[model samples]
Target: MTSRFERGVTYAILALFTVTSLTPVLGILSTAFGRQSSLDTGFSLPDGLNWGNFADAWSRAHFGTYLMNSVLVTAAVVTATCVLAVLAAYAFAVMRFPGSTVLFYLFLAGLTLPQEALIVPLYFDLRHWGLTDTYWALILPQTAQSLAFAVFWMRAYFRGSPRAVIEAARIDGASSWTTLWRILVPMGRPAISTMVVIVFMWTWNEFLLALVMVSDEAHRTVPLGLAFFQGQHSSDTVLLAAASVLIALPVVIVYVLLQRRFIEGMLSGATKE
Candidate 1:
């Protein structure tokens, strides 16, 4: 039913988008496996593939340690953010309190506040608390930073939930905590999953806080490690690309796994009708 012109335009747009999205990824992959002599040239498919780059990157960067640290930090952050966000969101959404709206707005203000703006104060605060150079420094502050957005997101989802179910649960003698854990949480899984993915991505990619907080080599996250790799040697392009791919692997995997739930949550949140 489509006209030729319309079909051509559609194809053009599709190709543009495909190229835009895949260009960097493909470039990275190609460089990761391509020969070292081609470093200065713009990305293209290599004539011969080299698997040695991955092995060299793995050993040179101590990416195994970095990966472990990243996983640990990410896991801790997601778990803490979910628990705190869910509880705070449930309170804000379901409970009645004086100045609750004002307080919630105060939390919402955190979304507008840039991390760069708070870096100086946060540095001193962490040092004062003797949390610097430790996992707690990174974990605690990151949790605090992520809480505002998490609460806002979760509260929106909770607010959109059916009130009748909550009322019925209350009438059935379900306690507040019981209702939240048993009823609201189960229903809000999609939203929670979306938040989890987003938070994981942000935390995984976070660099500044990780740089400021952890002085030790062993505690450096993937981003910091990648930055180090990029700066280590100008000629090490293949290894650099391999490291980049490894850095992005977890995010790609997680997104592929939960993309359905993420889309459902986003649609549910954005559409009122």
Candidate 2:
């Protein structure tokens, strides 16, 4: 009974904290639906609806092009990174081979390197290869950067997965590819969904790669485009909020949709066999 009481108290505290955290986000959401003058006094509900704010911001910021570029780059990075990371992580977690530990550690070492440290060299390397100002520039670097963490994330889950189940799949005549895709992949959803959410969020919000590697306005991702948008609409708080909401909506939506898997992945380590 005491433990149950304690659990109830804990949940109440967490619920309060969640509401507190979301207050700022709710404020910004309300701002997105109002006018610039609405903010001068304090936070409040829009007198009515102001859908034009979104239209104006979208039109003025040329967010259509920016959104397209973001979608393309993020989609490429997420797909390539997931495929490569899952393959590499499965080998690390399941296979026995020469120097696996060393290779794994080398991949892990990439986690320590900062993007700022690599940008200058990366810029030069891309320029030398004439890949600068191209979608490949954004796609490739983000994919590479994301792969390190994705491998790490997937490796933990894969290592914890049921060894008996894996053996059964192999004994049932499943090839390596068949076993991985047909058996282990379905069981690893929580981890995969978590990785997808993280990679999508990171790739969507990435600024430095877009700023340095993409020169053309047509190639600008939403975040970089938002920077220019902010510069132009510095005084229009309503428009800025709306623009931010538009840029951020996809990430929020993705998280909301995959939230169950994300939470499960986070809590999945303790029951490992």
Candidate 3:
């Protein structure tokens, strides 16, 4: 059992880390709400809540179009990645066939390759294929990129699943597809939810991929839009802060909604192999 002194130290350390992490966010919030004229007062609370900052930022930045593009791209990437990863992971975990080990290792190789290394060739390939400046440019590449980690994550969970449960399902004369979809998938809700949150955040915040793959304004994601917005409004701290908040709000909302499952998945040993 943990000692009282040890528990107290742990809580104190966690509290310090929490405040450290939140300090920058609080500073941004203060600047977002502060009067435009008070830009010189660094990190101080606003005299009054300036709600119009968000409205003005939204209008000036054209976030609606960018946000919608991000939503479409993120949703597509997450859905595709999850479906493909689950199928691939289930096969690796439960099925055996010729060259399965080699194939699985090849998938794991993707995790070692960084996006920067492939961006140039990938751009040329996408351009050659006439996919540049399109949603497919964003969605397809990101889905493929995310699949590496997604497969790795879900495979561990599937491998750690109870053997008795899998045997019982097999004894029921269930097909592999039925066992995966009905029994394993439902049982791994926490792990899947955790993967969703991670992949959503990654896809939503992806900037370099968007920049290299897409040049059309219609295909720009939030991070790309925010970069241009920042360039144009470099001096407008209030609007910048507000726009930053807007860009981050969706990710924050998603994590908040899935916080419990994410934590549960992380803390649980079900992913151990």
Q: For residues 131-224, what per-residue lDDT tens digits would candidate 2 score against the true structure?
A: 9999999999999999999999888878888999889988998888988899888888888988999999999999999999998998999999
Candidate 1: where are CA atoms >4 Å away? 1-12, 270-273
Q: List the candidate numbers ranked by TM-score, top first.
A: 3, 2, 1
RMSD, every candidate, angstroms = 2.2, 1.9, 1.4
Q: How many residue pairs clash in model 2?
A: 0
Of 1 and 3, the candidate ranking higher by lDDT: 3
Which candidate comes out best when scored by TM-score?
3
In order, what lDDT does every prediction score? 0.88, 0.90, 0.92
Provide the TM-score for each candidate, comma-separated: 0.93, 0.93, 0.97
Q: What is the alpha-carbon lDDT of model 3 when measured against the actual structure?
A: 0.92
Best by lDDT: 3
Estimate, for each residue in 85-142, the C-alpha lDDT of model 1 and write its tens digit: 9999889999998999998999899899999999889989989988888888788888
Residue clash pairs of candidate 1: none
